[model samples]
Target: MNEPTLPTLHWTRRALLATGTAGALSLLLPPVAAAAPEEMDAAIREMFGNGTIREGRVSVKLPPIAENGNSVAIDISVESPMTEDNHVRRIGIFSPRNPIATIAEFHLGPAAGLAQVSTRVRLAGTQSLRVIAEMNDGSLWSGKASTYVTLAACVIG
Candidate 1:
Protein backbone atom coordinates (compact mmCIF):
# COMPACT_ATOMS: atom_id res chain seq x y z
CA MET A 1 0.00 0.00 0.00
CA ASN A 2 1.20 3.48 -0.89
CA GLU A 3 1.01 6.15 1.90
CA PRO A 4 -0.15 9.66 1.04
CA THR A 5 2.06 12.63 2.02
CA LEU A 6 0.43 15.77 3.41
CA PRO A 7 1.55 19.20 2.20
CA THR A 8 3.10 21.61 4.69
CA LEU A 9 0.73 24.26 5.99
CA HIS A 10 1.39 27.94 5.35
CA TRP A 11 0.20 30.71 7.63
CA THR A 12 -2.43 32.86 5.98
CA ARG A 13 -2.58 36.63 6.56
CA ARG A 14 -5.50 36.13 8.99
CA ALA A 15 -3.50 33.68 11.09
CA LEU A 16 -0.37 35.91 11.22
CA LEU A 17 -2.19 39.17 11.79
CA ALA A 18 -3.06 38.29 15.37
CA THR A 19 0.55 37.65 16.30
CA GLY A 20 1.72 40.86 14.68
CA THR A 21 -0.99 42.85 16.39
CA ALA A 22 -0.20 41.29 19.72
CA GLY A 23 3.49 42.05 19.38
CA ALA A 24 2.86 45.62 18.34
CA LEU A 25 0.37 46.12 21.15
CA SER A 26 2.78 44.75 23.68
CA LEU A 27 5.46 47.16 22.55
CA LEU A 28 3.11 50.08 23.06
CA LEU A 29 2.45 49.08 26.70
CA PRO A 30 4.84 49.91 29.50
CA PRO A 31 7.10 47.19 30.77
CA VAL A 32 6.24 45.72 34.14
CA ALA A 33 9.18 45.91 36.49
CA ALA A 34 9.38 44.49 39.98
CA ALA A 35 8.88 47.02 42.76
CA ALA A 36 12.15 48.61 43.84
CA PRO A 37 13.14 50.24 47.12
CA GLU A 38 13.01 53.67 45.53
CA GLU A 39 9.53 53.07 44.25
CA MET A 40 8.54 51.92 47.72
CA ASP A 41 9.79 55.14 49.18
CA ALA A 42 7.92 57.06 46.54
CA ALA A 43 4.75 55.20 47.30
CA ILE A 44 5.20 55.91 51.00
CA ARG A 45 5.78 59.56 50.38
CA GLU A 46 2.75 59.73 48.16
CA MET A 47 0.62 58.04 50.76
CA PHE A 48 1.67 60.17 53.72
CA GLY A 49 2.89 63.35 52.15
CA ASN A 50 4.73 65.28 54.87
CA GLY A 51 2.80 63.40 57.55
CA THR A 52 4.89 62.47 60.52
CA ILE A 53 5.14 58.72 60.94
CA ARG A 54 5.29 57.57 64.54
CA GLU A 55 6.20 54.13 65.83
CA GLY A 56 4.08 52.60 68.53
CA ARG A 57 0.82 50.80 69.21
CA VAL A 58 1.10 49.02 65.88
CA SER A 59 2.05 45.36 65.73
CA VAL A 60 2.50 42.88 62.90
CA LYS A 61 2.15 39.20 63.66
CA LEU A 62 3.46 36.84 61.03
CA PRO A 63 5.83 33.94 60.84
CA PRO A 64 9.46 34.98 61.02
CA ILE A 65 10.18 32.33 58.45
CA ALA A 66 7.75 31.30 55.76
CA GLU A 67 8.15 27.99 54.01
CA ASN A 68 6.20 29.16 51.01
CA GLY A 69 6.19 32.65 49.58
CA ASN A 70 2.62 32.37 48.36
CA SER A 71 -0.24 33.41 50.54
CA VAL A 72 1.58 34.02 53.79
CA ALA A 73 -0.83 34.63 56.64
CA ILE A 74 -0.51 37.94 58.48
CA ASP A 75 -2.27 39.54 61.35
CA ILE A 76 -2.13 43.29 61.99
CA SER A 77 -3.22 44.90 65.21
CA VAL A 78 -3.34 48.57 66.09
CA GLU A 79 -4.10 49.70 69.60
CA SER A 80 -6.98 52.04 68.98
CA PRO A 81 -10.15 52.60 70.91
CA MET A 82 -12.30 52.57 67.78
CA THR A 83 -14.18 55.51 69.15
CA GLU A 84 -15.49 58.40 67.12
CA ASP A 85 -12.89 60.64 68.67
CA ASN A 86 -9.87 58.45 68.08
CA HIS A 87 -9.61 55.52 65.68
CA VAL A 88 -7.51 53.98 62.99
CA ARG A 89 -8.61 55.12 59.56
CA ARG A 90 -6.39 53.34 57.12
CA ILE A 91 -3.74 50.67 56.94
CA GLY A 92 -1.37 50.31 54.01
CA ILE A 93 0.89 47.32 53.54
CA PHE A 94 4.14 47.58 51.62
CA SER A 95 6.06 44.68 50.08
CA PRO A 96 9.40 45.86 48.73
CA ARG A 97 10.22 42.79 46.68
CA ASN A 98 6.85 42.10 45.19
CA PRO A 99 5.86 43.22 41.72
CA ILE A 100 4.11 46.16 43.38
CA ALA A 101 5.47 47.93 46.40
CA THR A 102 2.05 48.44 47.91
CA ILE A 103 0.66 45.01 48.56
CA ALA A 104 -2.56 46.16 50.13
CA GLU A 105 -4.32 49.26 51.42
CA PHE A 106 -7.25 49.14 53.82
CA HIS A 107 -9.66 51.89 54.83
CA LEU A 108 -11.46 51.64 58.13
CA GLY A 109 -13.68 53.82 60.21
CA PRO A 110 -14.72 54.05 63.80
CA ALA A 111 -17.47 51.57 63.15
CA ALA A 112 -14.78 48.98 62.46
CA GLY A 113 -14.09 48.05 66.04
CA LEU A 114 -10.86 46.50 67.30
CA ALA A 115 -8.68 48.01 64.53
CA GLN A 116 -7.31 44.53 63.86
CA VAL A 117 -7.18 42.84 60.47
CA SER A 118 -5.96 39.53 59.15
CA THR A 119 -5.05 38.73 55.57
CA ARG A 120 -2.79 36.62 53.43
CA VAL A 121 -0.31 38.24 51.07
CA ARG A 122 2.07 36.94 48.42
CA LEU A 123 5.76 37.42 49.05
CA ALA A 124 8.41 37.39 46.32
CA GLY A 125 11.26 36.44 48.63
CA THR A 126 12.87 37.23 51.94
CA GLN A 127 11.90 40.81 52.74
CA SER A 128 10.46 43.06 55.35
CA LEU A 129 6.73 43.80 55.29
CA ARG A 130 5.98 47.36 56.30
CA VAL A 131 2.64 48.50 57.59
CA ILE A 132 1.51 52.08 58.01
CA ALA A 133 -1.54 52.91 60.01
CA GLU A 134 -3.28 56.27 59.61
CA MET A 135 -5.17 57.46 62.60
CA ASN A 136 -8.04 59.89 62.80
CA ASP A 137 -5.80 62.62 64.10
CA GLY A 138 -3.80 62.61 60.85
CA SER A 139 -1.03 60.71 62.58
CA LEU A 140 0.66 57.84 60.81
CA TRP A 141 2.19 54.92 62.66
CA SER A 142 4.46 52.33 61.15
CA GLY A 143 5.59 48.81 61.95
CA LYS A 144 7.62 46.19 60.15
CA ALA A 145 8.16 42.44 60.26
CA SER A 146 10.94 40.45 58.60
CA THR A 147 10.18 37.22 56.80
CA TYR A 148 12.49 34.53 55.47
CA VAL A 149 11.00 32.66 52.58
CA THR A 150 12.19 29.24 51.57
CA LEU A 151 10.50 29.35 48.17
CA ALA A 152 9.56 32.23 45.92
CA ALA A 153 6.02 32.58 44.68
CA CYS A 154 6.06 35.64 42.48
CA VAL A 155 9.14 34.84 40.43
CA ILE A 156 9.09 32.31 37.64
CA GLY A 157 12.00 29.94 37.17
Candidate 2:
Protein backbone atom coordinates (compact mmCIF):
# COMPACT_ATOMS: atom_id res chain seq x y z
CA MET A 1 0.00 0.00 0.00
CA ASN A 2 1.11 3.62 -0.73
CA GLU A 3 1.39 6.15 2.12
CA PRO A 4 -0.81 9.26 2.06
CA THR A 5 0.79 12.40 0.53
CA LEU A 6 1.67 15.28 2.86
CA PRO A 7 0.34 18.77 2.21
CA THR A 8 2.65 21.31 0.56
CA LEU A 9 2.94 24.89 1.79
CA HIS A 10 3.03 27.76 -0.70
CA TRP A 11 5.19 30.84 -0.26
CA THR A 12 3.23 33.99 0.48
CA ARG A 13 4.13 37.43 -0.82
CA ARG A 14 4.89 38.76 2.67
CA ALA A 15 7.07 35.76 3.46
CA LEU A 16 9.00 36.11 0.23
CA LEU A 17 9.48 39.86 0.74
CA ALA A 18 10.78 39.41 4.26
CA THR A 19 13.13 36.67 3.18
CA GLY A 20 14.46 38.77 0.32
CA THR A 21 15.11 41.76 2.57
CA ALA A 22 16.99 39.62 5.05
CA GLY A 23 19.00 38.02 2.29
CA ALA A 24 20.02 41.43 0.91
CA LEU A 25 21.24 42.55 4.34
CA SER A 26 23.18 39.35 4.90
CA LEU A 27 25.04 39.95 1.64
CA LEU A 28 26.45 43.24 2.98
CA LEU A 29 27.96 41.65 6.07
CA PRO A 30 31.60 40.64 6.29
CA PRO A 31 32.40 37.02 5.70
CA VAL A 32 33.06 34.58 8.56
CA ALA A 33 36.54 33.87 7.24
CA ALA A 34 38.27 34.83 10.47
CA ALA A 35 38.37 38.42 11.68
CA ALA A 36 41.19 40.57 10.36
CA PRO A 37 42.47 44.00 11.25
CA GLU A 38 39.98 46.57 10.08
CA GLU A 39 41.01 49.03 7.40
CA MET A 40 39.97 52.66 7.91
CA ASP A 41 39.09 53.14 4.27
CA ALA A 42 36.71 50.18 4.30
CA ALA A 43 35.17 51.00 7.68
CA ILE A 44 34.58 54.66 6.77
CA ARG A 45 33.06 53.74 3.46
CA GLU A 46 30.72 51.31 5.14
CA MET A 47 29.67 53.88 7.71
CA PHE A 48 29.25 57.08 5.71
CA GLY A 49 29.26 55.96 2.09
CA ASN A 50 31.06 58.52 -0.13
CA GLY A 51 30.06 61.61 1.79
CA THR A 52 32.66 64.25 2.54
CA ILE A 53 34.20 63.86 6.00
CA ARG A 54 36.14 66.58 7.76
CA GLU A 55 38.54 66.41 10.69
CA GLY A 56 37.62 69.14 13.14
CA ARG A 57 35.24 70.14 15.92
CA VAL A 58 35.50 66.60 17.37
CA SER A 59 37.80 65.40 20.06
CA VAL A 60 38.55 61.85 21.19
CA LYS A 61 40.29 61.53 24.49
CA LEU A 62 42.06 58.37 25.59
CA PRO A 63 44.98 57.63 27.81
CA PRO A 64 48.20 57.98 25.85
CA ILE A 65 49.14 54.59 27.22
CA ALA A 66 46.62 52.21 28.75
CA GLU A 67 48.06 49.83 31.31
CA ASN A 68 45.24 47.39 30.63
CA GLY A 69 43.42 46.89 27.36
CA ASN A 70 40.36 45.38 29.02
CA SER A 71 39.01 48.68 30.30
CA VAL A 72 40.27 51.77 28.53
CA ALA A 73 38.48 54.99 29.27
CA ILE A 74 37.08 56.83 26.24
CA ASP A 75 35.81 60.39 26.06
CA ILE A 76 34.35 62.12 23.00
CA SER A 77 33.06 65.65 22.71
CA VAL A 78 31.86 67.49 19.65
CA GLU A 79 31.71 71.23 19.17
CA SER A 80 28.28 71.85 17.76
CA PRO A 81 25.89 74.71 18.15
CA MET A 82 23.32 72.27 19.51
CA THR A 83 20.46 74.27 18.10
CA GLU A 84 17.38 73.19 16.26
CA ASP A 85 19.13 73.86 12.99
CA ASN A 86 22.57 72.53 13.91
CA HIS A 87 23.20 69.79 16.40
CA VAL A 88 25.32 66.75 16.86
CA ARG A 89 23.23 63.76 15.91
CA ARG A 90 25.28 60.75 16.91
CA ILE A 91 28.75 59.45 17.61
CA GLY A 92 30.41 56.19 16.70
CA ILE A 93 33.57 54.66 18.11
CA PHE A 94 35.78 52.19 16.27
CA SER A 95 38.96 50.27 16.86
CA PRO A 96 40.71 48.80 13.85
CA ARG A 97 42.67 46.32 15.92
CA ASN A 98 39.64 44.81 17.64
CA PRO A 99 38.10 41.67 16.26
CA ILE A 100 34.91 43.65 15.91
CA ALA A 101 35.68 46.92 14.22
CA THR A 102 32.63 48.86 15.24
CA ILE A 103 32.79 49.47 18.96
CA ALA A 104 29.88 51.67 20.07
CA GLU A 105 27.30 54.17 18.86
CA PHE A 106 25.69 56.98 20.87
CA HIS A 107 22.70 59.05 19.84
CA LEU A 108 22.10 62.64 20.81
CA GLY A 109 19.85 65.54 20.01
CA PRO A 110 19.57 69.28 20.50
CA ALA A 111 18.25 68.72 23.99
CA ALA A 112 21.53 67.06 24.87
CA GLY A 113 22.99 70.57 25.39
CA LEU A 114 26.58 69.42 24.86
CA ALA A 115 27.63 66.75 22.43
CA GLN A 116 29.88 64.87 24.77
CA VAL A 117 30.01 61.21 25.77
CA SER A 118 32.21 59.07 27.97
CA THR A 119 32.50 55.32 28.03
CA ARG A 120 34.88 52.40 28.35
CA VAL A 121 36.01 50.08 25.57
CA ARG A 122 38.19 47.01 25.12
CA LEU A 123 41.23 47.12 22.86
CA ALA A 124 43.38 44.44 21.35
CA GLY A 125 46.65 46.34 21.57
CA THR A 126 48.17 49.62 20.54
CA GLN A 127 45.73 51.05 18.06
CA SER A 128 44.01 54.20 16.93
CA LEU A 129 40.61 55.08 18.35
CA ARG A 130 38.42 56.48 15.58
CA VAL A 131 35.45 58.70 16.37
CA ILE A 132 32.90 59.87 13.84
CA ALA A 133 30.12 62.36 14.50
CA GLU A 134 27.04 62.96 12.42
CA MET A 135 25.45 66.36 12.43
CA ASN A 136 21.86 67.33 12.01
CA ASP A 137 22.85 69.05 8.75
CA GLY A 138 23.67 65.67 7.17
CA SER A 139 27.40 66.18 7.54
CA LEU A 140 30.01 63.96 9.13
CA TRP A 141 33.16 64.82 11.03
CA SER A 142 35.84 62.53 12.43
CA GLY A 143 38.78 62.45 14.81
CA LYS A 144 41.31 59.84 15.85
CA ALA A 145 43.96 59.23 18.48
CA SER A 146 46.38 56.42 19.24
CA THR A 147 46.41 54.53 22.53
CA TYR A 148 49.01 52.07 23.71
CA VAL A 149 47.83 49.11 25.72
CA THR A 150 49.90 46.71 27.78
CA LEU A 151 47.55 43.82 28.59
CA ALA A 152 45.16 42.91 25.78
CA ALA A 153 41.55 41.80 26.02
CA CYS A 154 38.75 40.25 23.94
CA VAL A 155 40.97 37.44 22.68
CA ILE A 156 38.54 34.51 22.62
CA GLY A 157 37.59 31.76 20.21
Candidate 3:
Protein backbone atom coordinates (compact mmCIF):
# COMPACT_ATOMS: atom_id res chain seq x y z
CA MET A 1 0.00 0.00 0.00
CA ASN A 2 1.25 3.52 -0.87
CA GLU A 3 1.18 6.26 1.83
CA PRO A 4 0.34 9.93 1.15
CA THR A 5 3.31 12.31 1.24
CA LEU A 6 3.21 15.44 3.44
CA PRO A 7 4.36 18.92 2.37
CA THR A 8 7.69 20.08 3.80
CA LEU A 9 7.72 22.95 6.31
CA HIS A 10 10.10 25.78 5.26
CA TRP A 11 10.35 27.95 8.41
CA THR A 12 14.00 28.04 9.59
CA ARG A 13 15.10 28.59 13.22
CA ARG A 14 16.48 32.06 12.39
CA ALA A 15 13.30 33.12 10.62
CA LEU A 16 11.10 31.89 13.46
CA LEU A 17 13.26 33.63 16.07
CA ALA A 18 13.23 36.91 14.14
CA THR A 19 9.46 36.88 13.69
CA GLY A 20 8.88 36.08 17.35
CA THR A 21 11.27 38.82 18.50
CA ALA A 22 9.64 41.40 16.30
CA GLY A 23 6.16 40.57 17.57
CA ALA A 24 7.35 40.62 21.17
CA LEU A 25 9.01 43.99 20.77
CA SER A 26 5.96 45.40 19.11
CA LEU A 27 3.75 44.27 21.96
CA LEU A 28 6.09 45.91 24.50
CA LEU A 29 6.16 49.26 22.71
CA PRO A 30 3.72 52.01 23.70
CA PRO A 31 1.10 53.48 21.41
CA VAL A 32 2.04 56.63 19.51
CA ALA A 33 1.09 59.86 21.22
CA ALA A 34 -2.07 61.68 20.17
CA ALA A 35 -1.97 64.81 18.03
CA ALA A 36 -0.79 67.91 19.92
CA PRO A 37 -2.33 71.36 20.10
CA GLU A 38 0.27 72.75 17.75
CA GLU A 39 -0.50 70.01 15.27
CA MET A 40 -4.18 70.86 15.60
CA ASP A 41 -3.45 74.51 14.91
CA ALA A 42 -1.39 73.55 11.91
CA ALA A 43 -4.22 71.42 10.62
CA ILE A 44 -6.67 74.28 11.07
CA ARG A 45 -4.36 76.63 9.23
CA GLU A 46 -3.90 74.17 6.45
CA MET A 47 -7.64 73.89 6.04
CA PHE A 48 -8.72 77.50 6.62
CA GLY A 49 -5.56 79.44 5.84
CA ASN A 50 -4.04 81.99 8.25
CA GLY A 51 -7.36 83.54 9.14
CA THR A 52 -7.92 84.42 12.75
CA ILE A 53 -10.19 81.95 14.59
CA ARG A 54 -12.22 84.12 16.95
CA GLU A 55 -13.92 82.39 19.86
CA GLY A 56 -17.59 83.38 20.03
CA ARG A 57 -20.95 83.15 18.27
CA VAL A 58 -20.68 79.38 18.57
CA SER A 59 -21.63 76.90 21.22
CA VAL A 60 -20.36 73.34 21.80
CA LYS A 61 -22.51 71.08 23.92
CA LEU A 62 -21.44 67.68 25.16
CA PRO A 63 -21.44 65.70 28.33
CA PRO A 64 -18.67 66.75 30.71
CA ILE A 65 -17.97 63.07 31.33
CA ALA A 66 -18.38 60.57 28.53
CA GLU A 67 -18.81 57.00 29.63
CA ASN A 68 -17.76 55.70 26.26
CA GLY A 69 -15.66 57.43 23.69
CA ASN A 70 -17.00 55.31 20.88
CA SER A 71 -20.21 57.21 20.32
CA VAL A 72 -20.23 60.49 22.17
CA ALA A 73 -23.05 62.82 21.21
CA ILE A 74 -22.18 66.42 20.35
CA ASP A 75 -24.21 69.48 19.55
CA ILE A 76 -22.80 72.50 17.73
CA SER A 77 -24.64 75.73 17.07
CA VAL A 78 -23.61 79.08 15.68
CA GLU A 79 -25.54 82.26 16.41
CA SER A 80 -26.10 83.64 12.96
CA PRO A 81 -28.93 85.06 10.96
CA MET A 82 -29.49 82.63 8.14
CA THR A 83 -29.74 85.31 5.52
CA GLU A 84 -28.21 85.26 2.09
CA ASP A 85 -25.83 87.99 3.18
CA ASN A 86 -24.95 86.51 6.55
CA HIS A 87 -24.94 82.76 7.20
CA VAL A 88 -22.71 79.95 8.26
CA ARG A 89 -20.84 78.65 5.26
CA ARG A 90 -19.21 75.77 7.01
CA ILE A 91 -18.60 74.20 10.38
CA GLY A 92 -15.57 72.15 11.37
CA ILE A 93 -15.08 69.95 14.41
CA PHE A 94 -11.51 69.26 15.53
CA SER A 95 -9.91 67.04 18.11
CA PRO A 96 -6.38 67.34 19.39
CA ARG A 97 -6.18 63.85 20.85
CA ASN A 98 -7.71 61.87 18.02
CA PRO A 99 -5.61 60.01 15.49
CA ILE A 100 -6.68 62.69 13.06
CA ALA A 101 -7.10 66.26 14.20
CA THR A 102 -10.08 66.96 11.96
CA ILE A 103 -13.11 65.10 13.19
CA ALA A 104 -16.03 66.31 11.06
CA GLU A 105 -17.25 69.22 8.96
CA PHE A 106 -20.63 70.46 7.80
CA HIS A 107 -21.57 72.85 5.06
CA LEU A 108 -24.66 74.99 4.97
CA GLY A 109 -26.21 77.88 3.08
CA PRO A 110 -28.84 80.53 3.84
CA ALA A 111 -31.50 78.09 2.71
CA ALA A 112 -30.82 75.85 5.69
CA GLY A 113 -32.17 78.59 7.97
CA LEU A 114 -30.15 77.43 10.93
CA ALA A 115 -26.50 76.98 11.86
CA GLN A 116 -27.01 74.09 14.25
CA VAL A 117 -25.63 70.58 13.92
CA SER A 118 -25.90 67.47 16.03
CA THR A 119 -23.88 64.30 15.56
CA ARG A 120 -21.79 61.59 17.16
CA VAL A 121 -17.99 61.35 17.22
CA ARG A 122 -15.43 58.83 18.37
CA LEU A 123 -12.70 60.20 20.62
CA ALA A 124 -9.31 58.63 21.20
CA GLY A 125 -9.26 59.83 24.78
CA THR A 126 -10.19 62.59 27.13
CA GLN A 127 -9.48 65.90 25.41
CA SER A 128 -10.87 69.25 24.40
CA LEU A 129 -12.79 69.71 21.16
CA ARG A 130 -12.94 72.85 19.07
CA VAL A 131 -15.78 73.78 16.77
CA ILE A 132 -15.16 76.39 14.11
CA ALA A 133 -17.83 78.02 12.06
CA GLU A 134 -17.01 79.84 8.85
CA MET A 135 -19.27 82.70 7.96
CA ASN A 136 -20.18 84.01 4.56
CA ASP A 137 -18.38 87.22 5.43
CA GLY A 138 -15.04 85.41 5.54
CA SER A 139 -14.97 85.33 9.32
CA LEU A 140 -14.34 82.34 11.55
CA TRP A 141 -15.95 81.69 14.94
CA SER A 142 -15.01 79.00 17.43
CA GLY A 143 -16.31 77.18 20.50
CA LYS A 144 -14.56 74.74 22.84
CA ALA A 145 -15.65 71.92 25.12
CA SER A 146 -13.80 69.37 27.27
CA THR A 147 -14.84 65.89 28.28
CA TYR A 148 -13.41 63.03 30.30
CA VAL A 149 -13.73 59.60 28.75
CA THR A 150 -13.87 56.48 30.81
CA LEU A 151 -13.31 54.25 27.79
CA ALA A 152 -11.35 55.42 24.79
CA ALA A 153 -11.79 54.67 21.12
CA CYS A 154 -9.59 55.11 18.02
CA VAL A 155 -6.60 53.71 19.88
CA ILE A 156 -3.46 53.29 17.81
CA GLY A 157 -0.28 51.40 18.52
Candidate 4:
Protein backbone atom coordinates (compact mmCIF):
# COMPACT_ATOMS: atom_id res chain seq x y z
CA MET A 1 0.00 0.00 0.00
CA ASN A 2 1.24 3.45 -0.92
CA GLU A 3 1.64 5.85 2.00
CA PRO A 4 -0.14 9.23 1.90
CA THR A 5 2.17 11.95 0.41
CA LEU A 6 2.91 14.87 2.77
CA PRO A 7 2.15 18.43 1.55
CA THR A 8 5.19 20.31 0.26
CA LEU A 9 6.11 23.92 1.05
CA HIS A 10 7.91 26.10 -1.46
CA TRP A 11 9.71 29.49 -1.16
CA THR A 12 10.45 31.44 -4.33
CA ARG A 13 14.02 32.75 -4.85
CA ARG A 14 12.79 36.32 -5.39
CA ALA A 15 10.71 36.24 -2.18
CA LEU A 16 13.68 34.94 -0.15
CA LEU A 17 15.99 37.62 -1.57
CA ALA A 18 13.46 40.39 -0.90
CA THR A 19 12.94 39.26 2.68
CA GLY A 20 16.68 39.16 3.32
CA THR A 21 17.17 42.62 1.84
CA ALA A 22 14.41 44.08 4.02
CA GLY A 23 15.86 42.57 7.18
CA ALA A 24 19.33 43.86 6.34
CA LEU A 25 18.00 47.36 5.63
CA SER A 26 16.09 47.45 8.90
CA LEU A 27 19.25 46.58 10.82
CA LEU A 28 21.28 49.22 8.97
CA LEU A 29 18.79 52.11 9.37
CA PRO A 30 18.73 54.23 12.50
CA PRO A 31 15.63 54.65 14.59
CA VAL A 32 13.44 57.66 13.98
CA ALA A 33 14.28 60.62 16.18
CA ALA A 34 11.76 62.57 18.19
CA ALA A 35 10.09 65.79 17.08
CA ALA A 36 12.14 68.99 16.76
CA PRO A 37 11.73 72.74 16.33
CA GLU A 38 11.38 72.40 12.56
CA GLU A 39 8.43 70.10 13.09
CA MET A 40 6.88 72.64 15.43
CA ASP A 41 7.39 75.36 12.84
CA ALA A 42 5.73 73.23 10.19
CA ALA A 43 2.81 72.60 12.49
CA ILE A 44 2.47 76.32 13.18
CA ARG A 45 2.64 77.20 9.53
CA GLU A 46 0.03 74.58 8.76
CA MET A 47 -2.28 76.16 11.30
CA PHE A 48 -1.79 79.88 10.76
CA GLY A 49 -0.61 79.75 7.12
CA ASN A 50 2.13 82.42 7.22
CA GLY A 51 0.08 84.88 9.24
CA THR A 52 2.14 87.13 11.46
CA ILE A 53 2.19 85.65 14.94
CA ARG A 54 2.15 88.72 17.17
CA GLU A 55 3.07 88.31 20.80
CA GLY A 56 0.31 89.68 23.01
CA ARG A 57 -3.35 89.22 23.99
CA VAL A 58 -2.48 85.75 25.16
CA SER A 59 -1.16 84.18 28.34
CA VAL A 60 -0.06 80.69 29.31
CA LYS A 61 0.09 79.41 32.86
CA LEU A 62 2.03 76.38 34.00
CA PRO A 63 4.22 75.31 36.85
CA PRO A 64 7.76 76.57 36.44
CA ILE A 65 8.97 73.13 37.48
CA ALA A 66 6.93 70.00 36.97
CA GLU A 67 7.56 66.96 39.11
CA ASN A 68 6.42 64.71 36.27
CA GLY A 69 5.92 65.31 32.58
CA ASN A 70 3.15 62.74 32.22
CA SER A 71 0.41 64.95 33.52
CA VAL A 72 1.29 68.61 33.53
CA ALA A 73 -1.46 71.11 34.07
CA ILE A 74 -1.67 73.99 31.64
CA ASP A 75 -3.92 76.99 31.31
CA ILE A 76 -4.29 79.18 28.23
CA SER A 77 -6.18 82.43 28.05
CA VAL A 78 -6.66 84.83 25.19
CA GLU A 79 -7.92 88.36 25.50
CA SER A 80 -10.94 88.80 23.32
CA PRO A 81 -14.35 90.41 23.45
CA MET A 82 -15.98 87.05 22.60
CA THR A 83 -18.51 88.64 20.37
CA GLU A 84 -19.69 87.84 16.87
CA ASP A 85 -17.67 90.64 15.36
CA ASN A 86 -14.55 89.92 17.40
CA HIS A 87 -13.67 86.65 19.18
CA VAL A 88 -11.06 84.01 19.50
CA ARG A 89 -11.73 81.41 16.85
CA ARG A 90 -9.28 78.84 17.98
CA ILE A 91 -6.45 78.12 20.38
CA GLY A 92 -3.45 75.89 19.70
CA ILE A 93 -1.00 74.58 22.29
CA PHE A 94 2.45 73.66 21.06
CA SER A 95 5.50 71.93 22.55
CA PRO A 96 8.63 71.99 20.45
CA ARG A 97 10.35 68.97 21.93
CA ASN A 98 7.34 66.72 22.37
CA PRO A 99 6.92 63.69 20.15
CA ILE A 100 4.00 65.54 18.69
CA ALA A 101 4.58 69.27 18.62
CA THR A 102 0.95 70.32 18.63
CA ILE A 103 -0.37 69.13 21.94
CA ALA A 104 -3.94 70.40 21.88
CA GLU A 105 -6.30 72.63 19.95
CA PHE A 106 -9.56 74.21 21.08
CA HIS A 107 -12.21 75.81 18.96
CA LEU A 108 -14.53 78.52 20.30
CA GLY A 109 -17.10 80.96 19.09
CA PRO A 110 -18.94 84.02 20.36
CA ALA A 111 -21.30 81.89 22.40
CA ALA A 112 -18.44 80.43 24.43
CA GLY A 113 -18.14 83.69 26.40
CA LEU A 114 -14.52 83.14 27.35
CA ALA A 115 -11.39 82.30 25.38
CA GLN A 116 -9.71 80.05 27.87
CA VAL A 117 -8.70 76.38 28.07
CA SER A 118 -7.36 74.20 30.86
CA THR A 119 -6.09 70.67 30.52
CA ARG A 120 -3.33 68.19 31.18
CA VAL A 121 -0.67 67.44 28.57
CA ARG A 122 2.23 65.01 28.32
CA LEU A 123 5.63 66.52 27.62
CA ALA A 124 8.53 64.52 26.26
CA GLY A 125 10.98 66.65 28.17
CA THR A 126 11.67 70.14 29.43
CA GLN A 127 10.56 72.41 26.60
CA SER A 128 9.26 75.80 25.64
CA LEU A 129 5.48 75.83 25.36
CA ARG A 130 3.69 78.14 23.01
CA VAL A 131 0.06 79.12 22.79
CA ILE A 132 -1.40 80.65 19.67
CA ALA A 133 -4.78 82.25 19.54
CA GLU A 134 -6.47 82.72 16.18
CA MET A 135 -8.93 85.55 16.07
CA ASN A 136 -11.94 85.78 13.85
CA ASP A 137 -10.33 88.73 12.12
CA GLY A 138 -7.57 86.43 10.78
CA SER A 139 -4.89 87.65 13.16
CA LEU A 140 -2.69 85.57 15.40
CA TRP A 141 -1.56 86.24 18.98
CA SER A 142 0.91 84.15 20.93
CA GLY A 143 2.27 83.42 24.40
CA LYS A 144 5.32 81.45 25.48
CA ALA A 145 6.46 79.82 28.72
CA SER A 146 9.16 77.35 29.69
CA THR A 147 9.01 74.48 32.13
CA TYR A 148 11.53 72.16 33.73
CA VAL A 149 10.48 68.54 33.98
CA THR A 150 12.16 66.13 36.35
CA LEU A 151 10.79 63.12 34.50
CA ALA A 152 9.89 63.01 30.87
CA ALA A 153 6.86 61.48 29.16
CA CYS A 154 6.14 60.17 25.61
CA VAL A 155 9.20 57.97 25.48
CA ILE A 156 9.46 55.95 22.27
CA GLY A 157 11.07 52.61 21.80
lDDT top scorer? 3
Model 1: residue 91 alpha-carbon error in angstroms: 0.4
C-alpha TM-scores of all predictions: 0.76, 0.73, 0.78, 0.77
lDDT of 1 by residue, 1-157 (tens): 4543533333456568888998889768643335787878778878877788888888998898988888799999999999999999999888787877888889998898799999998888888888999999989999988889898775543
Q: Candidate 4, TM-score vs. the true structure?
A: 0.77
lDDT of 1: 0.84
Per-residue lDDT of candidate 3, residues 1-157 (tens digit): 4543532333465678899999888768753458888878887887777898898999999899998889999999999999999999999899898867898879999999988899999988999999889999889998999999988885521
Residue-by-residue lDDT tens digits, candidate 4, 36-72: 8898988988887899999999999989998888999
**Pairs with steric clashes in candidate 3:** none
Rank the models by TM-score, top first: 3, 4, 1, 2
**Clash count in backbone of candidate 3:** 0
- Evaluation by TM-score, superior candidate among 2 and 3: 3
RMSD of each: 10.6, 10.7, 10.1, 9.8
